[model samples]
Target: MLLKTFRWAFAVTALGLVAGVLYDGWTALGLVAILAVLEVSLSFDNAVINAGILKKLNAFWQRIFLTVGILIAVFGMRLLFPIVIVAVSARLSPSRAVHLALTDKDRYQELVTDAHPSIAAFGGMFLLMIFLDFVFEDRDVKWLSWLERPLARLGRVDMLSVCLALIILLVSSMTFAAHAHQHGGGHADKAQTVLVSGIAGLITYLVVSGLSDFFESRLADEESTKSDGAGRPAVALAGRAAFFTFLYLEVLDASFSFDGVIGAFAITNDIVLMALGLGIGAMYVRSLTVYLVRQGTLDDYVYLEHGAHYAIGALALILLVSIRYQINDIVTGLIGVTLISASFYSSVRRNRAARE
Candidate 1:
């Protein structure tokens, strides 16, 4: 089962490495390997979150995710997205951005780094909303009951998650972003950029998530009324609901990729190498998500979702902090892995107790 799931990931890794070596010899190959590992470690939580969502879609959408979705993730997010950022931020044309990336990698890296504040704010706020909604929602299976219970009760207040996210964005903008601008002496107003980007992020989350939930709920209601002869809602989501859900997943993947894309510069500034490495990692993440869904990992280990959300919350905060301060990727990766491991252990203990 494991081999069946990861066959493509392995194939990609082999091809990516061979391409890397042919492009720039052993040095490039090493950097590619490091960057691939970095992306996988940083995005393990993302795979978990994606599995939770991807399982709702039908096999057609799942195939779309593994095929067309991967093309978008690899080329769009890992490669073209950075170029787009540079072009927009630096007021250059698309072709010029590509030229700069290929010809002047150091300058390319600088422009990308200069754009980090807005990127972080946007990605941070989007992820923050995701984490907030998860924690605030009332779930029968609670991981941290003492804390989750209170939050769930407060969640009954309509739009509470949006309210809290906006407040946090405001405070972060006024405090961290403003302070960073004053100390760093950047020409742009970091605070203003952060406020604008954060709001954009918040609105994006609302639109994508709201539309997805609305369509999905309508589909559920429709499906609930008509079941198979065995008396079950059709096991797959389809139509507009599936489209929106797929859209939501892509946006979620983009938000998660922001930091990794920028952080890749620290290892290597070659655009082709970055794409090859990150693309391999992304393939693995998608494979892992499919494996979890097919294996029923989440159903068996209920708290795993909770832990991934908490890791997401931590990552959201880290992204916000990174706008003003530098954070080691290792630290970010360790925090996520730790939370997931703890939850897995707890799930095992619960299973053992139930058996007894």
Candidate 2:
């Protein structure tokens, strides 16, 4: 299973290293290796969360995820998405954005960095809502019963996750605004940018999640209503579910990739190298997600999802705080790794006790 999952990752990593060396010698190779590691480290929790979602998908959708989905992750998000961001933000044509990225590396990076506040707000709020929803929703099993129970009770309130996210965004924006004012900077603009981006994120999450839920529920109803003699219709129902599931996974991947893309700049300004390294890492993450889902890791290691969500919550806060402060990406990644590792260990211990 490990070999099946990681075979492509190894091949891609080799290709990335070769490309790295050809591009700018051994130094570039080393940088690519470091960036790949960084991407993988930062995205482990993302893979865990993805597994929880991907397991619900059918075999066809899972295959699509491995094939078409990886293409989207590699070229679409890791490569083209950055260029698109630069184009839209700087109001440049796509060709112009590409030229700027290749010819004037620093300017390209500056444009990307300048747009970080909005990106952070959007990605951070989206992730925050994910974490909130996971924590607040009632479940048969609880990892942190004391905390989750209270949150679950609160979840009964309509749009609780949306409301809490807005409140947090408001607080974060106000805090940043005050700090900017004290420093004689663009206070109101900063606040407005954060608010608007966060609202956009919230609306996006609501809409995408709503659509997915609606289709999923409809599929469930159809499946339940089908007589035993009917078996399962392979095309219509499954295709619709697969389509929406694909969209959900793609959006989820985009949200997860935002921080990795931005953090890659801290390592290298070369867009090609960044894409190669991060793309390699993203492929590994997708593979890991598939492994977890196929192996029932989420079911076996019961608290794993809880840990992943908690890590996500931490990451969301870090992203938001990073709008005003420069936090180390390694530190953020390490926090998530630690939380999930601890949970895995706890799960092992619990299983051992259960067997005894």
Candidate 3:
């Protein structure tokens, strides 16, 4: 089963390595390997979250995710997205941006880094909404009951998640402004950019998530009227629900990739190498998501969802913090892995105790 699931990932890795060697011999190959590992390590929580969403999709959509979705992730997010950011942020044309990337990598990296504040604010707010909504919503299963229960109760208030997210955005913008002022820089433009970017992120989450939920609920209602022989509604999402869910997954992926794309410059500024490596990692993440869905891993290990969401919350905070401060990618990766590992251990204990 494992081999069946990961066969494509293995193929992609092999091809990526060969491409890396062809691009610049051994040195490029090493960087590609490091970047691949880095992307996988940083995106483990993403795979978990994706699995939670992807399982709802029908097989057709699932295939779309693995095939078309991979193309968008590898070329769109990993390569073209950075170029787009540079073009927009630097007021350069698309051709100029590509030229900059190819001819002057250091300058390209600088432009990308300079754009980080807005990128972080946008991605951070979107992810923050995701985490907040998960924690605030009432659920029968609680991984961190001590905290989740109270938050769930508070969630009874309509739009509390949105309210809280906006408040946090305000505070973060103010904090950025203050930090800039302290450093003897103009704060107005920076603060305004953060505020606007955050609102854009918040709106994006609302639109995408809201549309997905609306369609899914409608589909559920429609399906509930019919049943298979076992008297259960078909749970596989299709039509509009599947489309929106797929869209949500892609946006979620782009948000997650923002930091990794920027951070890849620290290892190597070669765009082709970065795409090759990150693409391989992305393939593995997709494979892992499919494996979890097929194996019913989430159903068996209840708290895995909780751990992924908590890791997302941590990442949201880290991205927000990074607007004014530098955070090591190692620290980010370790925090996510630690949360997931702890949850896995707790799940094992729960299973053993139940058997006893």
Scored against the true structure, residue 174 in model 3 reaches a CA lDDT of 91
Better of 1 and 2 by TM-score: 1
Query: What TM-score does candidate 2 get on C-alpha atoms?
Result: 0.94
lDDT of each: 0.92, 0.87, 0.91
Q: Per-residue error at 235 for model 1, in Å?
A: 3.3
Q: What is the TM-score of each candidate against the true structure?
A: 0.97, 0.94, 0.97
Estimate, for each residue in 104-207, the C-alpha lDDT of model 1 and write its tens digit. Answer: 99999988888888999999999999999999999999989999999999999999999999999988888778766432455347888899999999999999
Models, CA RMSD each: 1.7, 2.7, 1.8
The sequence of per-residue lDDT tens digits that candidate 3 reaches over residues 205-317 is: 99999999999999988887796766556769999999999999999999999878877888998889999999898899989999999999988888898999999999998
- Provide the global lDDT of candidate 2 against the true structure: 0.87
Residue 313 of model 1 has an lDDT of 94
Model 3, runs deviating above 4 Å = 177-185, 228-231
- Pick by lDDT: which candidate is best? 1
- State the lDDT at 219 in candidate 2: 80
